[model samples]
Target chain A: MRNIKLIIEYDGTRYFGWQKQPELRTIQEEIENAIKKITKEDVKLIGSGRTDRGVHARGQVANFHTNSRIPADKFKFALNSVLPFDISIKESTQVDESFHARYSAKGKQYRYLVYNSKTRSPLLRDYSYHVPYTLDLYKIREGAKFFIGTYDFRAFMSSKSCVEDTIRTIYNLEIIENGDLIELKVKGNGFLYNMVRIIVGTLIEVGCGKKKIQDIPKIIESKDRNEAGHTAQPQGLYLDKVFY
Target chain B: MRNIKLIIEYDGTRYFGWQKQPELRTIQEEIENAIKKITKEDVKLIGSGRTDRGVHARGQVANFHTNSRIPADKFKFALNSVLPFDISIKESTQVDESFHARYSAKGKQYRYLVYNSKTRSPLLRDYSYHVPYTLDLYKIREGAKFFIGTYDFRAFMSSKSCVEDTIRTIYNLEIIENGDLIELKVKGNGFLYNMVRIIVGTLIEVGCGKKKIQDIPKIIESKDRNEAGHTAQPQGLYLDKVFY
Candidate 1:
């Protein structure tokens, strides 16, 4: 048996997510259907993690075992023909029998885009969130420094999260300004449920002058969900990449 | 009454089209709904032209009359609040009473994007057409020469189009290659129904080396629908800009 790994990309606007649930159109189900049609195997694909509905991914990874004769890299070309235009397998490679897509992941990177302007953008509306208010870029940068170390982020975890460990190492957190768009990029060893989003929301509050740059430390120290800023909307967040 | 002109942009994937059709979600209908909510007016906002379903726009223009107390430019913010996320008024200004969105335009630009790769792109699936084969770029340039100058493009018009005069001037026809993407940008005084799409189809045929490049003049002179290429899909086309 050979394990195949896939680097996938998708527009999550029309999908339920990466899991297969009855009555819900998910990326996983669509990919599985395509695979079944090509190989006639009812193989289950395991994804790196669960991305919420309407959250896009550029480099989502998945793996499944198959006894098919086709080359691993050729799966990208074969699967794309059967799948809808919204989902695509960008790259494929054969893996060792011991490799697991989920368990082998060392870290994950996420990016949240904010389209800051006096008016919302038309072409980018579906993909990014529109915030028409002025954001203080310097203040937001100062607040980002607080989230760059290992901490118990219990305050940022959501009630719906099943994560047992609230402590995680944040390798990097950056707020970059590019023309009219502001991108918040965060890389962590592991994230609590909604942790990245809550961090972004808190930073946004600081950007909007609602909170001082020093408030992020206090919010993290409190370990209360209410102490954090706000849970940022899901539409702006994207799972950029998962490192194995 | 103040006549306000708008430079608009939208991702038309969710819209029926630019015009308001009964029981269908149209761009015009959404903008009109937002206008009615703000000014209590049931005015028709006239667009420069109709874009078929799944078409996008960057600088499509529209004009409407209103007696609202808000300034013209501020309408961008006001209307965007109630309008769908995919539609945006990029720029708004008060125009002379004699100005009209459709009639005042001297020329308009349209662009169609194609991804020429063996593996389809997951990020731009909805935004571009995938042609997973190698094509000769020089041949396409020869065929596009026939589209320059002027022609009565009756053969290229769709059967569904309702128009009498098929004569239109083609100001410029350009085929540009950018990375993995090929962009077909055409500027014309006007276009007949599906004229740009048909031209694109013919150019793609030329690019694929299926049709001889120098045979373009005969194809146009033939004025037979069967002589031209297939109608390109609407999803890859966009109204790039409108010239006043």
Candidate 2:
């Protein structure tokens, strides 16, 4: 059996998420169905992680074992031809039999976009969170510094997350401003459920002066979900890259 | 009676067009219904111009005569509350009774976005035209310069256009490249039907070496629709601004 790795990109606006649900449409289900048509095998596709509904991806990684003789790279073109316009395979390659999409990943990067303007943008409605308030970039940058480094990020995760380990190392976090858009980029060893969105929400509070920049450390130390700000909407979050 | 002018924005993905067609969902129909709900008046909504199906708008202007006592500016907020999420009123103000939406416009600006890359981007799928071939930016820039100035644009318009006068003055036409995206911005006193799309198509041909830069003048002089390149798709065209 050959382990094939695929780099996927999808607009998650109309999807339930990255995982397969019983009845609802999902990114994983669509790709798997496309594979079945191409390889004539009921392959089990394993994604690096799950992205929530309305969350987009640019470099999401997935792996599947198949016995077909199709060249690895050709899978990108073949699958894209059958897949819906919203989902596409950016790249594909053959990997060692032991390689796993999720377990072998060393780190991941995520980006959350916010349209900070008095008026909402029709072009960006699906891709960005529109905040019709002036955000203080200086305060946002100050708060972002606290997220870097290894720590127990229990406070940033959703309460519904079933994962036992709450500890994670954030390698980098930065805020980039372009015109009326604010982008929050974060790289971490691994993220807890809803961790990125919650972090963005907290930072937005800091940017708007609702929360002090110095309070971020205390919030992280508290390790309580309630202590953090509201979870930002899923539409603004994107899986930017997966490092292996 | 007051003539209320509105600056509008919309994602045209799900809309048929800017015009109100019986039994068809359109931007004008939606706004007219919203107006009826707000003021209980069967008012006629006139747009600055008709944008084809799947064409977006950032600053599309429209006007309507109403006798309601509701403040002019408040119409923006009122209409937005009832309009679909894809449509938004950016600004609203009272104009003179003689101000007509279509006839009184002095100029218009349209922008066409092309994603020039080997791989298509899911994020820009709705807004940009994907062209995988390598294009010569220099050739496109050269071709654009020929389009600046007054000319009879019959060759660049759709054959279906019924207007007798095809002469229009192009104030500026520029090609801007940012990363993998190419922006074609054109400002003109008036445009023939499908004029901008056809111009973009011809320029794309020029960039790809399919058509020479010197052929543009002949295409314009021919005054035949068949003389120009194919009309580019509607999704990439945006009504950027409408001048009074």
Off by over 4 Å in 1: A21-25, A29-42, A68-85, A138-156, A159-179, A185-190, A214-227, B20-25, B29-42, B66-86, B90-92, B119-123, B135-195, B211-230
Cα lDDT for residue A201, model 1? 88
**CA error at residue B130 for candidate 1, angstroms:** 2.1
Per-residue lDDT for B60-159 in model 1, tens only? Answer: 9999998887899889888888888789888989999999999999999999998897777766776888888887888887778888998888878887
What TM-score do all the candidates reach, one by one? 0.79, 0.95
lDDT of 2 by residue, B15-122 (tens): 999998888899999999999999999999999999999999999999999999999989988998888889989999999999998999999999999989777788
- Evaluated with lDDT, which candidate comes out highest? 2
lDDT of 2 at B69: 95
Task: Name the lDDT value of residue B52 in candidate 2.
Answer: 91
Chain B structural similarity (TM-score) per candidate:
0.97, 0.99
Query: Residue A13 in candidate 2 has what lDDT?
Result: 96
Q: Write one digit per residue (lDDT tens) for candidate 1, span A14-42.
A: 88878889999999999999999999999
